[model samples]
Target: MTSAPAARASMDAGRALPPPVLVVSIVSSYLLALHPGTLPRDATTTAVVTSGFAAVGAVVGMLLSRWASRRRPHPDTQTRRVVFGAGVLIAAGGAGLSVWWQSLIRAAVGAPPVGPDWWVAATVAPAAAVAAIVLIPRVTAVIAASAVALAAGLLAPADAGADRGQPSPRTIVVSEFGTLLRGELAAPEFDHPAERLVRSWMHSGGLAARAVIVAVPTGSGWVDQAAVAGFVDRFDGDVRILTLPYADVPSWKAFISDDATATESSITLVRELAKVLANRPAGDRPRLVLYGQSLGAVGADAARVWLEDHHPSLLAETVLTAPPAGTVAQASRTPRIVVANRSDPVVRWSLGSLWRPPAYPDDTVLGGRRVPEVPWLPVVGFLQSSVDLLAALDGPTGVGHRYGTEQARPVSGLPR
Candidate 1:
């Protein structure tokens, strides 16, 4: 009895998205944004992240709807009643989550709640959900492929013979030191750098120097110039600082995948230097210090452990700045000083931190100086800490993961 146009209309109506899908998407978006991060996000970032969450939520909602539909083919009235019930529950739950987020944010920052940001998320979530449900795998595929292509081009390792075009940030920093010292500091550019650097140091009469500091570089091969400057200041320009290039990737990537590169490279350099150091008398030998920050600290600590086992007397001191949780070795005889900030996510973030509170180094004199304590709340703490890791470096000199020349200060009463 129905006309063709009416039948087409009925089909279109049937294809319309279920009410619970939109509710789930919006709820999911808000839930993710509820977690407090190290840095409070701006409206733009909040919207973008919420939208991403909404898109994922939309897919999940669609699947959930399919399952529910198969389980119970409800009539129109029953569906409306179910939708109303979900909406009411969502409203009440959202209010509770909002209050919790407000309290955490308030505690982190003195005043001015992140209430407005929630609106940004709320406004963006439903629209993002609708778009995701409509433009799904096609749009996702294109974006993913493009992102992969871009990352591949940027991250691909260059051949040694290939012209890298411009020098990297690490090279610039190292080269700048050479220019500043007027060629007194030799940053080796050629192959067999460990042997070449030691040879250069020896040629420059570094063997006769009062002290030598082996500066373990960050994952990206960046040796902190401040730390080097601090060492120079401490030794009164009689210290020969040495470092070698390792991986050229970001610290996190190197931390996860190529951390062994740092440890092994450090060991190789120290071993070569140790062989040369052995030629001199024990009391006349240069005071050897191992210095590392962040990922560098992880490597340097591991090397320190190795040195303790093999060449114990060669290393005078080990300085580990902001080393990550669970990475420090327990069995080292060398005088080790760990400089960690109270609020440093790097020092606190581990698998165990998900449940148990992080334990600070009892031996560290410089640990936990500033910042109010961030209360730990089971799963919430883990989520916040995970987010905090991204912005750990954004804080001031003494806060979070940012350490200063103070990190290079010699431990009190330690023989330098």
Candidate 2:
């Protein structure tokens, strides 16, 4: 008789477990349907939707726990086990569905599908479920159920959205030193075939005129698609922008030593550019300008020196924007301009050595009487607006080291 009661109790417990699992799975599925786009592009939309799900889960969990608590309990070990197994299956199913949805979205957008990583969603769900089961008994299963419901609401959908497809941003690869070498040799070409602005710009200018504008990317890795197109469209003269491949070159003896193989590779690039610039006819000899941001500034500075020493007349100007940690000295006999912004955090860290008051006094004359403190966002936005390089030249003024705005002017009386 006891065995019969135990069997009946187990069956009852088993029946109880499915409701929670079904609730969680349904919630997860619903969230997976709403794909929030990637960061910066759809940040606001993602945040709003995520918050909404969290709120709804909290209310539903509370109500479900209250209803479950009032029901008569049965001691059914077999039923409990069955329910637990079912919950696990539901969790696994939800995760699988999320992965499939993400893959489909990526395929639709021409992005590489993300493969199943052990680290993604599989680990979190089980742990959360176990926590809910353990806590519910001690604190009135109603409260525990509510907590689990809320957690499920927040995490299940958030995970689904996190799995949303991301289209790979276009990338251009070139060596650190290879960029200068390319500039020295042939005029740069747009790497991406889809860039309409670059094609249009090239069509407008004849071959000779198009050769003057040199495109210098700032950091390592793939270049930004919008930035590349924007530069091409906004350039007043003939422009050639080269996208360098991503390579890590730390500022250490291993990388920068004169005898280092990497150093040699860098120098070879400069030599190539010098040879190219040297061969051009006087009428066709374009004024070389080095434009670089961040670490690219260092490469540009080095290339400028190499060109001036070997082919002095080729260099017209050097523009260093948000250069890495280094003193900006004369890269060549030609004129050099440094554009810094006040609001850039990275630039501030870089400017620590460069912005000494005693050695590198602020040039008040060039900055005008009132210093400008343009925010980083506006400056970056302005750059993105396809403004002419000449218009982009004037930024904000302050002691801060920013990229887009005119922060601090170079010390006056320095020879151009």
**What is the lDDT of every predicted structure here?**
0.65, 0.39
Q: Could you say which candidate leads in TM-score?
A: 1
User: How close to the true structure is residue 99 of candidate 2, measured as C-alpha lDDT?
Assistant: 53
How many clashes (backbone atoms < 3 Å, residues ≥3 apart in a chain or on different chains) does model 1 have? 0
User: Count of backbone clashes for each model?
Assistant: 0, 18
Over the stretch 1-416, how does candidate 2's per-residue lDDT look in tens digits? 56988978766756655455334543453343232211111223322333334234434644564677578564245655665576557546655654555455344434455543321323343344334543463454576469679978775211100012321123322224222112111112322321332333334342345334333433222232333343344444235554332232222222233212222233344454455567777667544555555455556566667667777777666656555334345333666665543322323333232333112112211221222232323223332122111122222322222232231122235321
Where in model 2 is the C-alpha error above 4 Å?
1-207, 213-216, 222-237, 246-267, 330-332, 348-416
lDDT of candidate 1? 0.65
Candidate 2 has a TM-score of 0.36
Per lDDT, the best of the predicted structures is 1
